[model samples]
Target: MAAAPQPLAPDPAADLALRLALTIRHDGQGGVADDLVDPDGLTRWVHAHAAALPAGELPFTADDAALAAVRDLRAAVRALFARAVPGEPSRADARHLMPVEEALRRLNAAAAAVPVVPHLTWPPGDGPAAGHRAAAAGAPAAAALTAALAHAAIAFLAGPDRTRLRACHAPRCVRYFLKDHPRQEWCSPSCGNRARVARHHDRHRPGAGT
Candidate 1:
């Protein structure tokens, strides 16, 4: 049987962090139904989501640059998976790989900054009024962070298989993918064939003897 795509390591915290990056990347690549959303917009939405959650905080600012950084990180992450391996982070063009590694480190750090109660089970309606007041008090930082965390968790986990979470193999399809089948050899078979022909020509042409 063909080998299964390596399962993502099971660390909900890390998964959630990665999810934010995935969502951001998905939005950037227009994979979430091809809306062509800006990375910043996604970040704002994530931030808002985390804020709404009771156990998180919002950052001080959701400015263009901050969102841009988030976008850049998302691109870096997508690139990392696009050039993947049997297990995890695979090697690729250094030009692309370095940025992705850097982004992973930075993004992980950013995710760590927000404090989240991994899984909280509050008694139903026991003291919701107090919780709301507390959330309101923490809106700027704590509340926003909660929304961001929840967003990241949902984005990272609970999605399609890893195949849909791949990078285009075509020379020109450098962007991430979320639709092509996992067994697909190329973003487009025509492109795949073109690459094969190019490789064959390079290997067998004139002076290029085996």
Candidate 2:
């Protein structure tokens, strides 16, 4: 079986929105890779991201419609992510990114596709933490999943975590990541190494920094 185009380590704090944006990632061979290639891929992805999505009593299986919906939403998300961070965005889809307004419209439309309500919980000493649950129990699985993904994106964009979002411009790397430390530049150690090597080459080329 053909594997995903790009397979890299998962972010330590894998926020759902971040995860969705990461569905398209660097192949480490100077090419962009996509994970959601078909219905099976979508089903796997959704099931794997259970913690980040709304809880369903029954397992949600993806169909062609679900796959298409999520993929389109991802395009909007990645475009918005590009706008969120500083400097150049991922090269793979930079040329074809939808307009900012269009992206917002799509996100909103997907989010509203399913009715949802806040599920809140307050522990002993902590404030209430809010979560989501589809208001309609019988809503289509596809709609619920896509809406959940869209809702996660909205939360991520509006939350403080968005401030730390960064674009990894390391050589052969194309991803958006949350900066864990003040000095973190690349998404992972491998990317950092690649970037360092690239920089060293740039500094010690035949021209010798002319």
Candidate 3:
């Protein structure tokens, strides 16, 4: 056998956050690219959480309720990711907070069924510089998640840096991304397409058709 396909391994917390961000943003499209995804209310939560983290600070202000909600959501998301596997389901005290915790618990079961192979790690803990290099080499989802965690931890511990954070530009969509592209707009094409279609219809409708 060719190495027996090592099991997947991802940073449970970071992976969960990122996954939750993407999932909530697009309404868990079942990983289907063409599927129509909606932002809903939870999507807004992700955007707010990501935005709270600023350029040089952790974005956790004692006076900011938004930041507090983000903290709760983060904790709930962490629980879902950490207790993803069978035998011990994740639970959270989000009763006073958003239903994101419960939402993710349901979503986690779906994720585990996807048959995704965990990413591998090599030369582990050598630091983020090398971790990023490996991530660039397509280290798999788990590896990628771990690398993401490393970046977040660094920012949390050593101060923030504007590396991959971004805000969407779509009129109605408010979400954050890893800044994979410099000109990214809205969080997904669905938002862009919806805007475009609505505009097109408005322009060609009844009296305006002139």
Candidate 4:
């Protein structure tokens, strides 16, 4: 069995977007390494993010339509990030924007139908201040799950943290990542190594230095 990809960023919302973008891993040579193309794989992916979701917001199983919807949303997210260039206004071409708009529409409908209530809880120690929590208001599991994912995407794109969004610079890596530090680029150490090795080979390739 293939191991699940680990979160690469600190923020949960950004991490969620990155996770969806990487459901299908790419080989360093323009090929697929692992693919979560079936409904079972998608269900596992949904369950893995359960902690970030409100309780009972995810269904016990995923239907074919739900799986297809997730796949489409994943593609839209990847396209948005891939086309975004630094120091420019974030924009998506029509092909990508259509799906994004559709996702926003679905999210809006879900949120309107089943609102997430806000509540407060006390801190662990020493502080009397409380943190706010959002709980789903009894909606269908599939709708709730879709709302959660859509919320994450909106937060990542509309918030200031969107500046940190980046596509892994490693060759043939289709994965996206959030920069954790000023110098961070590759999504992981393995990708970093792969990029460095590729650079080394490029410099040594049959060059006549003429």
Candidate 5:
């Protein structure tokens, strides 16, 4: 059997949108693994992504309802990501992807659910930065978080960097990654090695050179 895909190392340079799509990845058991499996998971993920989220959006505590909302948004994000890459979709849910049209609808709806206003902040020498603030004073935490993620995803997909998106087809990897370098193939060095090994075995196997 093929070696299962491994979890990737922390990459601070990855876009927030791409990071969210990566929450659903390959498990060691040759199956899919979801990071946002519960309210705690969702809360952890939100805090981990603090640098990219809006300022007032911090201090978040996810409940079951927020967990469900975020997971639904994540599903739409992954489905759209699967459609953005060059080759085949990730094997994790290739047969179960929502239609591109449906994914689009869900994403748009989530993004529009929470109204937002522009925010500008400057951290000393870090220079001025522009972000958003939730305009709906009564909006639930779930709505705010979901809209933030959806907007980030929209920006990534509609920007030039979209061309860098690629799906890792090595072994059991079910990841979508940005091709940081021109020659990069797999999602990581380990995946590249696995692909190379699989290729070598395919070429040298018992075909008797026929």
Candidate 6:
């Protein structure tokens, strides 16, 4: 059997939207590495981020169709950010927005049966808390998953942090990361080294800039 795919490293400051869009890695050699290609991987992804999901409504058995839908949604989100982030006058392409809109529609349809309400509670050994909960019992798991992802995407795009979203321009790297620091560019040091090497190679190419 193939080795199980490694879980994505968690960044306390990264939002769900950034994480979701990065499910596919652009190999810089004109190919992509998709983590959601298998049902088991998809299931693990959902479980790993269980906190964002509705209580006990995890989509642990993602079918082929569900996997395809999520992949398409991921692509659309990536494309949307690619265009929206760097442009002086940012604009969303209709093509990219369609899938997101469709996802949201499905989420709304699926959530029709669930009621969202706010509640307060004090954990047995923790401080009191207040938060909203979706009464997701009996709700379709696939729909709940889609809705949760869609909602996160919407919030990320519409919120103030959208300006800080960026795609790593490093060689052979296709990951998205939040600009936590003003000078940060690549997603990681490895990517940064790759980018520097590529630049050095380009500058030293035979008869370059002649």
Tell me, by TM-score, which candidate is best.
Answer: 5
**What digit string (tens of lDDT, one per residue) describes model 2 on residues 1-210?**
985345333332248888888888888777878899899988888778776666682387778998999999999999899898878786656787999999999999998988788788889999997776888788787777778888878877877777788888887666898876677888898998988999999998898857
Task: Work out candidate 5's RMSD over C-alphas.
Answer: 5.7
lDDT of each residue in 8-100, candidate 1, tens digit only: 453343344445444522222323332115545655565554534444333444555555555555555555454442333312223455554
Over 32-147, each residue of candidate 6 has an lDDT whose tens digit, in order, gives: 67778887778888788777654555537887766776666676676667755663211222223445456555434433434556668798999997654565456566655665
Q: Candidate 5: where are CA atoms >4 Å away?
A: 1-14, 123-126, 208-210
Which structure is stronger by lDDT: 3 or 4? 4
For each candidate in turn, the TM-score is: 0.43, 0.85, 0.30, 0.71, 0.87, 0.73
Q: What TM-score does candidate 3 reach?
A: 0.30
Model 6: lDDT of residue 166: 70
Model 1 lowest lDDT segment of ten: 27-36
| Of 2 and 6, the candidate ranking higher by TM-score | 2
Task: Flag regions of model 2 displaced more than 4 Å.
Answer: 1-14, 120-129
| Evaluation by TM-score, superior candidate among 3 and 6 | 6
Global lDDT scores for all candidate models: 0.45, 0.81, 0.37, 0.63, 0.82, 0.64
Clash count for each candidate, listed in order shown: 19, 0, 2, 0, 0, 0
Candidate with the larger TM-score of 2 and 3: 2
User: Which is the better candidate, 2 or 4, if ranked by lDDT?
Assistant: 2
Q: Indicate the residue-level lDDT of 183 in model 2.
A: 73
lDDT of 5 at 148: 88
Tens-digit lDDT track of model 4 for 1-210: 986555444466767766776775666566655445877887888888777665565555887876776666665566555545354222212223445455556545544544555455456876563222335355555555665666666667777667777766676665666776777877789889988999898888897353
Error of 6 at 177 (Å): 0.3
